[model samples]
Target: MSVALEVKNTYEDFILEKDILYFRVGEHGLVSFHGKNYHIKKRLNTEEIQKMTSDSSFFKVNTDCYVNTRKIQHIGDGKVYFEVRGSESKYTTITKLRQHRLKEIVLQQKGEA
Candidate 1:
């Protein structure tokens, strides 16, 4: 479930609608889709983003990140991991503390299916 978001930087506002794999905590708030990360210029944070996108298939995997569960290839070691756009061996992770919630979300979705 790719989502379209409006994000702003120091200079401009940009539309970022992509097949977001995951968001990693970084210098600019969150790093995402195909390495196209952005800090929302005091517009939004991780929690806000989660709330905004949850019904569209985003989940707060941990404190430091939110992930599009549909893109998750694996979850482990307090992290949710997935493939990047053009990489085989390379993947990304977001910190996960109470990892069981991830399982529950998957299970719940599967039940729906």
Candidate 2:
């Protein structure tokens, strides 16, 4: 079973760490799960959310987005791919600076380190 990370939002619900694809900073933090986006309570930013979801599976992909590595279908050619609901796939390009870090994490996860 995936570990559950409780995040208090307007709905006051718990979100599974594995179900989270990414978190982005907007007016409030937006936590993406599958195809849905949840507004994280006003106080938390992507960095705080990262701390809350602290695990090897989560990493900051850019200045505004933090991605869950476990949710990644693949990462290459500067794109980070994620599996969503149906026929559609979601992808976000990583910054050149952070791309190398993400690749390291992916390799470490695969026990290739």
Worst 10 residues of 1 by lDDT: 33-42
Against the reference, the lDDT scores of all candidates come to: 0.54, 0.66
Runs in model 2 with CA error above 4 Å?
Answer: 1-14, 28-50, 53-56, 84-87
User: Which candidate's TM-score is highest?
Assistant: 2
What is the C-alpha lDDT profile of model 2 across 1-113, one tens digit per residue? 89999665534454546446766655566544332344343456778666655655667777667777776777878878886555566777788788888888887777853
Alpha-carbon runs more than 4 Å astray in model 1: 1-18, 24-56, 84-96
The Cα RMSD of model 2 versus the native structure comes to 7.1
Residue 63 miss distance in model 1 (angstroms): 2.6
lDDT of 2 at 73: 73
Candidate 1 overall lDDT versus native: 0.54
